[model samples]
Target: MASATEGAGLSVDEESPVSQKREERLRKFRELHFKRNEARKLNHQEVVEEDKRMKLPANWEAKKARLEWELQVDEKKKDCVARGEDYDRVKLLEISAEDAERWERKKKRRNPDPGFSGYAEAQLRQYQRLTRQIQPDMENYARQREECGEDFHPTSNSLIHGTHVPTKEGIDRMVEDVEKQIAKRSKYSRRRAYNDDADIDYINERNAKFNKKAERFYGKYTAEIKQNLERGTAV
Candidate 1:
């Protein structure tokens, strides 16, 4: 039986200088790793505290109420539009003095002329156009009749006829314009992806690009296993 001192001596003798250096390196690595881990933990804690300090405090309840109010109003407007009803602007909350004044000014701007609207102005424009067109033709006809005498009768020969036929170039230009409009519409049209399998082609293409990498990894791992087996080493 070996005594304690003798056993200790044998163990120390079995350990080489290289083994001692390896043990020392392991101890230093453990110490370094522990310090690094502690530093990382401390940094993360500091970041969290900094974020907490920087975040501004707000009235969450009030914010939620305001957002909900806006949503409700938007839904109401949509409902009105869907029903083909006129959208009456409704105030959701009281406005500030400045906002109220701005709203009043906007309303006044909608009808710049106090008693007249855009429709009325358009009607007046149509009436003036008709008067100008009819008056000129009537005056010319009256002058012709006066010069020809009252007994003079009008015939188809007296009426001048005009014919306008588009040239081939003009017709081709118009067709090209129509084709451009059709192309523009088609360009902006969206293709619907309405099924789970709609993106299969894209997924397959992406996977194909990575297939070689996957095969290489598999080959590398198998090669390592084969080498280990030949060397009689445990995997």
Candidate 2:
């Protein structure tokens, strides 16, 4: 009887060490996972707070100012029309000297070429005035062309090459095309135009060489040239 009881006690003491180890390991794993989740949650909150703090009010203000200026310009245009004056021929009113200088600085920053030095605020104002004057005629021309089923080709007498004379559709189309070309050429032109250390003469020379090559290619491809002419893509 005593041997049977001792055998039972031995059996009870023989619990598996591996099972105990596994339970401890599982506990540690759960603790670590919980800590990691908590840390991630804290990090996310920090990011949200940082984003809120970094949001700028300046851009909103600038946008508001631009909208106000546009409204004022539209009001002036309406007044000119009411007076029976050619709204398109209205000249730019004189701006303050400070504003003019600021505009000049901005222009210089955009196109740093010494050749661009002659581009004063006064010149810009004059150009704007001319553009305004021609806009109505351009619209009328486009309307007429569409009505008559004629090709609409407007020519500009402005000193700037390729400035299409004011016709609403023509001006709009030309401006869009010009903007696209500017973006396409930005990679090459930015370095030449904006880089202070860049040599302007070298840039000009490269442009001249490229233009000559383009001209030669266009001359050889008469069919392509004709297509471009018809599409108004030559410019």
Candidate 3:
């Protein structure tokens, strides 16, 4: 009876050592996770701020500095004029070496590579501009190649160069390029000849068509009257 009482007094460990360790690990993990989340939040905010800064105009600071310099110069010119001194001499002729160098740098920036390094560079730029305008129609090109067959491809082997296979990347690029071209074409119209010999007496194409119909139906009856009116003889 005394041994049973002693056993009952020694309480049972409902949580084992392993479970205590696991609970401790879990609490540590939760703290680390919270710290990681805070770090990620900070990193995201930094990236957003960086993007905003990048979107600002690069030359804005330079422009502001230049404007400030101009304002100071204007004030100096006013003082020179008041003192009956030569403003041009004070402004231009009396410029320091630093100012001269700065002016040269500004001029260089304004007209960087005013002339081409070589004719080859000009040719390359022209070629690039032409190539940029070339939006490939793969389906049409394929159809043409099929029609031409050996005539265009110049292939003898049926097994080797049977047909040109397009990649998925190429197909997607063509689709995006075509959509861009369509968008560009929508914003543009063919400019008509400004110095046409024929007189334009209508406000628009529709008006021009209406005038043509009126003239066509009644031209014969009014022809003599029109001629007489032109000669200032129609009363």
**Candidate 1 lDDT over residue span 5-106, tens digit each:** 899988888887779899999999999999999999999999998787577456756887999999998997898789886566434343578998998899
Selected candidate, larger lDDT, 1 vs 3: 3
Q: Local error of candidate 1 at 69, Å?
A: 39
| Candidate with better TM-score, 1 vs 3 | 3
**Candidate 3 at 35: error in angstroms?**
1.1
**Root-mean-square deviation of every model:** 26.4, 26.0, 27.2
lDDT of 3 by residue, 93-114 (tens): 7789999999899987893334
Span of 10 residues, lowest total lDDT, candidate 1: 158-167
Each prediction's TM-score versus the true structure: 0.20, 0.25, 0.25
Could you tell me the lDDT of residue 32 within candidate 3? 100
Could you tell me the lDDT of residue 71 within candidate 3? 100
> Residue 131 in model 1: shift from native, Å?
77
After superposition, candidate 2 runs with Cα above 4 Å error: 16-19, 46-217, 223-235
**Which candidate number would show the highest lDDT if scored against the true structure?**
3
Q: Clash pairs of candidate 3?
A: none
lDDT of every predicted structure (CA atoms):
0.70, 0.70, 0.81
